[model samples]
Target chain A: MLVQFYNVSKVYPKGKALDDISLKIDRGEFVFLMGPSGAGKSTIIKMMFREEEPTRGQIFIAERSLVRMKRSDVPRVRRGMGIVFQDFKLLERKTVYENVAFAMEVVSAPHREIKARVPEVLRMVGLEDKENSFPGELSGGEQQRVGIARALANQPLLLIADEPTGNLDIDTSLEILDLLIDINRKGTTIIMATHDRELVKAARKRVILLDKGKVAADYAPGEYLVC
Target chain B: MLKNIWYFCREAVKSMARNHLLSLATISTVAICILILGMAVLATLNASHLITRLESDLEIMSYLDKDLTADQASEVKQALEAIPGVESVRFVSREEALQYLQDSFGEDRYNLEETMGKNPLPDGYEIKALDPHQVPVIAQQVEQVAGIERVNYGKEMVNNLFLATKWVRVLSMAFIVLLSLGAIFLIATTIRLAIFSRRKEIYLMKLIGSTDWFVRWPFFIEGILLGTAGSLIAILLLAVGYETLIGSIQSVPFVPVLSNRALLIEVYAGLVMVGALLGVLGTYISLNRFLDV
Candidate 1:
């Protein structure tokens, strides 16, 4: 298994966001987490990214204790995984090419490596023709494609998408889901959190249902249902 | 590190140029302050040189009575030499004194023989002091000597010159202090204004996981460039100003000796350091408040 959550519970001052949650997904597994509002779906992905930590117990990605890692080491943990957010988080002023190239630059990858790798990533996202375009000039779907290109630029072993299609229509949403599936087929482990039951049923992938924090059901090739 | 500094400088220069009014204000403030300080330094140097020159040149003149017997005149000369601060006392014989007057006035056509019914001059001791300020005290003591008719120590003129020198020092020091403060404040505010304007970029850089050094380099480099360029300008102006205005004084030798060339360079060097330091310090201060937020 590449991830393990050992009796982990995350509580905010307001209330418990995650209550004694425990689950493990192995390497190269494509899993979907389906949950209702305030069910800790975002919290789970945040914990996995080391953006937030559980209140008790422990969590590990690649068998490294993310709960115990120093704040400065968060980048190193992130270096191993690619994450996509709902908002795209793209630098609006920068060109599409520079936006994708930024991730490699942060890791101190040599100039030639960035130059060679950026175009390849842009090509994979099918935005090769729009590499010179800015994010403001692109549609939501196209901007999300740039975000995916940025996330996957460093070839992270794991790709986590948090509500990736939360802001898109049914047609555009499925297009994004297909891109995530395509990225998974290329050998990257994928963990996606979403509330789109119709899409989950259509995709037929492994699904974990969270009801009020704990995992209510874990099913292989399952539908997105809490019960 | 070199590459980072170069990149940092390039961005800083570009931004400063884009914000032309701000760069001009910073440079102007630095120049005005430095110009004032440069003038103060030059004036102070001149006044000090003059005081020392006057101190070395002052002498005690002990005039003898024209009716003094030969022995009485000799006694006065010997007594004047014994006074403290008297380095040497030369006896000016009546005939020698008369001949000196003729030589000095010959060109002026002043007939000394017609001015006096007789050779009305008398022998006296022209006494030199180690310092001019001591001339008055020595003159007072010389007044008590027998056979000495009067003393011509030029006390009144010397006292007025000393007072003028003191006033110059007081005024210049005040000017330099005021100007330095003006420069510090100007540079600090210039940097603050610049940093305040681009605070959005800084916030984004921080959230993007850029380290403190990565964020600080641009502001640090901007300060240095402003200081260097402004000071360099001041130095060039000072160099030209000195050559045009002060060069004549140097050749005249009668003008108090001042190290014009050196002070001009010091003004530039001082401004450069001061300007840069103020820029960096001001940026650091502003960043502390802004970054912590």
Candidate 2:
């Protein structure tokens, strides 16, 4: 298992956000956290990245216990995973090439490695031709591709994307899904949280449905749609 | 680390340029604060210097017995010099004392000599203490010496000067400390506003696995740059104003102001260091709120 949650719970001032949730994701699996708003899908994703600590219970990512991890060690763990956002957060002033290279720069990668890898990652996202274009000039789909490319620059073991296609049209959403599926095929575990029921059904991946901060269903590929 | 610093500097410059108006405001505020602080420091320095000059000039005048022989008077001088706190003792003969009075009379010296047929001035030994605070004690010791008639050292005036300067030093020190705190708070608030403007950028940096330090380095550099620039302006202004004031007062007598080039350089260096320190502190306080993620 690449990720494990042992009876984890998260409590806020108002109420419990995640109540005694437990699940496991193996390496190279494409898992969809399908739920409506306030389903704790985002909360679980946040815990996996150590953005929020579990109020109770333990979480282990890559066999390292996140509950016991030091605050200073968060960056090192985060570098091992990529994160994509719905709004496609990219520095508007930077070109497509610089945007992707920023991830490596933040880690202080060697100049030679940054020079060689940035173009490679941009090409992987099929944005090699738009390497010099600014985010403001790019279309919405192209911008998200840049976001994915930047995330992949570190060559993470897992990719956690929250609502990656929440703002896209149906056709563009499917295009992004195909790209995600292609990346997963190349041996990267992906856990995406989204409310787009049709998109999840189309991906044909393992689905973990959450409702009211608890796991509602755990179904294998092609099985979730049947239920 | 060197590479990271370089990147941080570049980003800091970029951010500064992006918010040129805000940057200018912060720099000017720093400059004004430092300028006021520098003036206060210079004032206190000058006040203390003047007091020290006056204290050094303070001396006890020990009158010799009118009938004492030259040998006995010389013995009193030797005894005064032997005192632990005595720097030196100069024996002034009655003739020299009379001549000093004559010189003071200027054109009327002949009239003063004609009015008093014989020189009745008593000879005195001028005693200078090593420490100004020991002047009274040294005067008392001088009076106890044989052949010494009386000792006078302007006791009340010296005590008043010391008391006044003590208050001046205390008040200035308190003022400087309060001003420093005010400056730090101002810089912190300004930097906080600047950081607040780019909160989204900081959030994204945190999301992308940048360490808190990594995200903070740029803002730190920006703050330091602002502080340095502000202090430089203040130093420039202070140097010019001080130099001009010194020029205007050059012909004036008895007013001791700081004019040592080395000392002025040291003060400027101190201001720069203080400015940079404030910058770092302000950046740290401002960045603390945003880096929790």
Candidate 3:
């Protein structure tokens, strides 16, 4: 298993976000987590990156339990994973190239590697010509594409995206989804959280329907039972 | 590692450029604080030097017995010189003593010579002690020497100089420490504002798996640069101001300040060290509060 949530539960002062949730994702699998706003999809994504720890039980990535890991070791674990946010958190001050290059720079990647790989990743995202354009000048779709390219810069094995297409129109949403699916097909395990039922039904991959804080249903391709 | 430090330095320069006004404010505040502190220190140093000169100038004048011959007076001078704390002993004859009186009397030299037919001034030995504090003990020993009448040194003058310089030193030291702390607080506030403006960058760095140290290095470098720059400015101002002060007060012989070459190097070096120390300390405080990963 590349990722595991073993009876993990998160309880805040207000209420429980995830109540005894247990799931496993295999290597190179594309999984969709579907639910309403309060269904703990984001919490699961946060736990995978060790951003929020489980209030009870444990989580592991590549068989290493993150609960017992030292705080200093969190960065190393996170480096092996890429994350994308719902609102397309691209730095407004940075150009598309700088936005993507920032991830590599933070890890102290060599200048030559950064100079070479940034353009390649921009090309992969089909924004090669827009490398110098700042995020403020780009459309919503283009900004999200820059966000994806930045996430992919480090070549992480696991890509956890929270509502990746939440802010786009139907056409743009499909385009972004197709890009994610293509990236997933190229041997990256992708777990995306979304509330768009139509997109979920169309993708038809391994769908884990989260209701209230627990996994309400789990189905494979061609076996999804939409609510 | 060298490349990483170079990156950090570059980032620090970039950050300072981004927040130019705040950086300037911090540097100016630090410079002003150090300037006041340096001035206080210099004042204390000059006061202390003057007091030391006054103390060293203290000497005991030992008058000889009236019936003592010239040979006996020379023997007394040699005996006083042999004492442990005695620096030197010079025997002044009656004629030389009269000439000293005449020189001090200036225009009244003839009137004094006519009024006093005989030279009543006694032959005495002027005794200088190695340690000014040991003057009383040396004076007592000189008075007990054979053919010596009495030993005289200005006790009250030495006591007043010690008391006055002691207070000056204590007050100036307290003022310097307080001002330094105030300067550090202002420095930290300036860095804190810089940090506040770029908090999003910090958050992004942490989210993207940058180590705590990687995110902190730039800010650390910024703090150091601010501190060192402020100290350099303060030192320059102090050097110019002190030279001017010494120039204008050249006629005041009693001041007895240290020469420019000596005091300048010492004060400049001390200010630089203090500025750097405060910079590091201010950075530590700010980072400790905001840079938690």
Candidate 4:
């Protein structure tokens, strides 16, 4: 197991966001967190990366307890995984090449390695030709590809995408899903949160359905469609 | 590490150019504050220098009894020199004293010499003390010496001058400290504004696992650049103004101003160092809030 959540719960002043939620994910597995808005899907994804802490439970990523980790160690943990956002957070002024290279630069990668890896990752995302284009000049799908390239720059072992296709159209969304599936086949664990049932059905992967801050069902491929 | 620093510097310069108006405002504020501070320091330095010159010029004049012979006068000079605080003593004979008076009379010297036929001036010793503050005590000791009839050193005037110079030093020090605080505050606000404009980028950087120092380096470099630039401008202005003032006052008598090139260079160097320090302090203050991620 790569991630394990034991009886995790979160409480806000309004009410509980996650109640007694326990789940596990294995290495190289592609899991879908299916839930409607306000169903605590984002909260679970946040907890995996240690962005949000559970009110009462233990969270282990690769056997290290996130709840007991030091503040200084948070960045080291985050570097082991990549996060994709809904809006495609790319610096508008930077070219596609620079946007991706900035990630490695921040981690103090060697100059030669950065020069070699940036174009390779951009090419992996099929954006090698758009390297010189700024975000403002690219379409929404191209920008999202840039975001993915930047996330993959560090070659993390796991990728947590929260509504990564929420802003894209149906065709573009499918193309992104295909790209993610290709990445997952290359042995990176993937957890994507979304409310689109059609997208989940298309992936035909393991699905964990959440409702009212609790787990409603956990189904394997084809089992969710049958039910 | 060198590459990272180079990247940080490039980012800093780019951000500064992007926010040129705010950067200009911050630089001007720093320049004005430092200019006033430099002026206050120069005033204090020059005032103290003048006071020192005046004190060094002070001498105790002790009159000898008219009945003392030349041999006895030389003995009195030796006695004054033996005093603990006395640096040196010079004997003024009656003839030299008369000659001094004649020179003071200038064109009327003949009339003064003919009006007083006999040489009635008394012999005296001019006494210099090692420490100006000890002049009063030395004068008292000299008055007690035998054959010394009286001593005069303008005690009240010296005391008043010392008091005035003390106030000048204290006030200027206070002014410089307050101005430094103001400069730091301004730089802090400027850096805070810069941080605000790039807050989203900072958030993304943190989310991507950038270390706190990585996120902080660009802003730190920006603050340092702002501070160094402001101080350099102020120093240039100050140097030009001081040279002009010195030129205008060269012919003025009894005013001891600072004109040494090496000392001015030292003061300028000190100002630049202080400006850079203020920049670092301001950056630290502003960046503390955003680095928690």
Candidate 5:
């Protein structure tokens, strides 16, 4: 398994965010976490990135339990994964090229590698002409595309995107989905969380529906019930 | 490591430039506080020097009655020499006293002789005391001698000088500590504002797997630069002001001041180090609070 949550649970002071959740994702799989706003899909994604720890149970990424890892080791684990959010958190003052290059720089990537890889990622995201443009100058969808490019800058084996299309129009959403699909076809495992039933239907991927902090249902590709 | 340092320096310089007004405010506040602290240090050092000189020179002067015969004056001197803590007593004749005054007046002796034909200076015994703390007691004993006119021991003046020196020491220490705290708080707030302005960048950096130190290096450099800059300005100002004061003080002839080159260098180095230290402290405080991720 590439990622595993063995009976993981997370409880905030307010309530239980994820209760008794167990699941497994294999390598190169494209999985959808379909749920409403309070279904704890984001929490599950956060646990995978080690942003939040399971209150009770073990979470393993590539067979190493995240709960037992030291704080200093969290970054090493995150380097093998890429994360995207609904807000498309880009540094507004930085150019698109800088936004992607910054991700590599944080990991102390070699100057030659950064210089060579940033342009390639920009081209992959179809933002080659806009590399020099600041995020404020781009459309919402283009900004999210830059977000994806930045996430992929490290060329991780796994990608976790939380509502990647939540802030986009339907046409832009499909484009972003197509881009994700293409990246998945190139062999990166993807776990995307969203509430859009129609989008999930259109993608025809394996779906995990969460309700009230539990996995309500699981469906194979092209067989999900619209919830 | 060298590349990271270059990047940190570049980023620090850019951030400082971006918030030029706040940076200027922080720097000026630090400079002014350090300048006051330097002045206090100089004052405390000079005052202690003056006190040491005064304490070492403690003496009791007992004037002799003009009508006393030579034998009576000799008897009075012998009695004074017998007093506890009296090291020695030297008798000055009327003529010798006048001559001593003339010597002390230097080039103005001729003018003093022209102004007054008769010798008006008093003949007295200069008594050196073994202990400065006992000068007042020995003076009281000498005043009781039969042929002595009056006693002058500078007791009140010495007591006041000691009191003033004590206060100066206390006040200078308090000022240094208070000013350092104020500088730290101001620098910390300014750095905090800078971090807040770039919070998005920091958050993104954290998400991309940068270690806490990697994210903090640029801000730490920014703080160090501000601290050093502020202290350097204060040191330059103090040097100019102190050198001018020294020039003017030379005309006053006898006011003790700290003019040793080594001591001045020590003060300068101390101020610069303090500035840099406070900068690091302030940066540490702000970063710890905002960079928990």
Candidate 6:
């Protein structure tokens, strides 16, 4: 398994965000975590990526103990995974090329490697022509494309998307899903958090359902039925 | 790192250009502070020059006692000239003194000598010394000269000059410190406000994973620009002030020392350094408050 969560629970003093949940996923698996808002879907994905640690229980990534990871190793852990955010958090000041290139820059990729890899990732997201465009100049869908390109820039082993297609239209959303599918088929483990029902249902992927911070059902080829 | 600094400096210049009003106000503040400080320095410098001139002019004029014989007075004059502090002694002969008195007063003072039934004027040695500090000590020792009756130095005038110059020195040092601090505060606050305004950019940069130093470089460079610009402004102001003063002083040939170019250059360079210090200090203040957090 590339990621494992053992009795993972997160408490925020007011209430729990994720209840005692245990799940495991191996390499190259495509899983959809479906839940309505505040169902702890994002928390699970976040914990897997170490964006936010579980308040309790052990979370593991690539057989490494995330709970015991040193502070300096956080970036190293993150470098091994790709994250696509819902808000399309592209650096507004930076161009599309620089936005995608930033991931490579932080990992200290050599210049020649960045030059070759950036355009390739952009091409994967179908944003190869908009390299010089800024985020504000791009439409929401196009901006999200740039965000996805940035996430793929590191050619990570694991892909985590938190509501990745929230702002896209139906057709645009499917295109983004297809991009994620393409990436997963290339041997990257993918965990996508979403509230979209039709897409998850039609895709027939393995689905984990959460309700009130606890995993309500784990279904193969699941739909958003637990809601 | 040099590349990073270039980017930083470029950003700094860009910010300075964009925040034109703020930059102008800060630069003017620094210029005014340095200008006042530079003037005080120039004053003390000129005062020191004047003191040196006065010290060089000091010569002890010894009056020979009327009862002394001509040859005895001559011998005492030679001995007085040979004293350690004594550089050279100009003997004011009685006849020469009489001629000098008549020439200065425009009257027949030579007739008063006949009326008094004795030559009132006595031959005296005008004793010179290497330093003004040695004057009192040398004067006291020379009082014992065989034909000398009095060794006077017009204590009232010399004491006033010393007191005045001592006050000028105290004022100069105090003024310099206060004005430099003013410049620092102005430039620092300016940089802080500049950074505060661009805090959104800062947060965006941080969120995008720029290290604290990389995030701070622009503001730091802005500070360097402020310092460099403030100093240049201050230097310019000082030059204008110096020229205006020199123009007035030029017609009056009595003020020869203020015409020095080397001292003026030194003062301008010093103001430039003060500006640089203000720039660095201000940037540090802003960065320490904003970036480290």
Alpha carbon lDDT of each predicted model: 0.79, 0.91, 0.86, 0.88, 0.88, 0.78
Write down the TM-score of model 1's second chain: 0.71
What TM-score does the first chain of candidate 4 have?
0.97
Q: What are the per-residue Cα lDDT tens digits for candidate 1 across B56-120?
A: 77777788877888887777777877777788989888778888988988755876877785777
lDDT tens digits by residue: candidate 6, B39-155: 778877887888788767777878888788878888997788778877887888888877777678667645655666765687777888887767777888789877798877766
For residues A1-227, could you state the per-residue lDDT of candidate 3 as single tens digits?
Answer: 99988999999999999999999999999999988999999989988988788899989898889997898998889888888888988877788999999999999999999999999889888999998999999988988999899889999999988998999998888888889899999999999999987887778789999999999999897577545
Best by the lDDT measure: 2
Instruction: Write one digit per residue (lDDT tens) for candidate 1, span A1-227.
Output: 88899999999999999999999999989999998988989999988876688899899889899887775666667778877878888876679998888766555556788899999999998999998999999999999999889889888888888888888889999998899889889899999999998889878899989999999989887444333
- Write down the worst ten-residue block by lDDT for model 4 chain B: B105-114
Clashing pairs in 3: none
Tens digit per residue, CA lDDT, model 2, B1-293 = 88888899999999999989989988998999999999999998998888889889999988989999878877877888888999988888888988888888786637665788888889899888899999988888888999999888998998998899899899999999999999998999999999998887788778778899899999989999999999999999999999999999977987777898999899999999899888888889889999988
| Cα displacement (Å) at residue B270, model 3 | 3.9
lDDT of 5 at B164: 78
Which residue ranges in model 5 land beyond 4 Å of their true spot? A225-227, B56-167
Chain A TM-score vs. truth, each candidate: 0.96, 0.98, 0.98, 0.97, 0.98, 0.94
Binned by DockQ into CAPRI classes (incorrect, acceptable, medium, high), candidate 1 is incorrect
What fraction of the native alpha-carbon contacts across the interface, defined at 8 angstroms, is recovered by model 6? Answer: 0.03
Residue B61 Cα positional deviation in candidate 3, in Å, after optimal superposition:
4.7
TM-score of 1: 0.61
Which candidate leads in TM-score? Answer: 2
lDDT (Cα, tens digit) per residue for candidate 4, span B62-153: 99998898888888888888999899999888788888888888766385657887887888888999999899889999999999998999
Candidate 2 to truth, TM? 0.95
Give the residue spans of candidate 6 off by over 4 A: A1-94, A98-114, A144-227, B17-33, B55-134, B137-148, B207-211
Clashing pairs in 5: none
Worst 10 residues of 3 chain B by lDDT: B284-293
Which parts of model 2 are misplaced by more than 4 Å? B98-120
| Poorly placed runs, candidate 1 (over 4 Å) | A1-26, A30-75, A81-83, A160-163, A191-227, B1-211, B230-259, B285-293
For candidate 4, write residues A201-225 as lDDT tens digits: 8888999999999999999866777
| lDDT tens digits by residue: candidate 3, B7-94 | 9999999889989998898789778878888888887777777778888888898889989987877888788889998888887887
Better of 2 and 3 by lDDT: 2
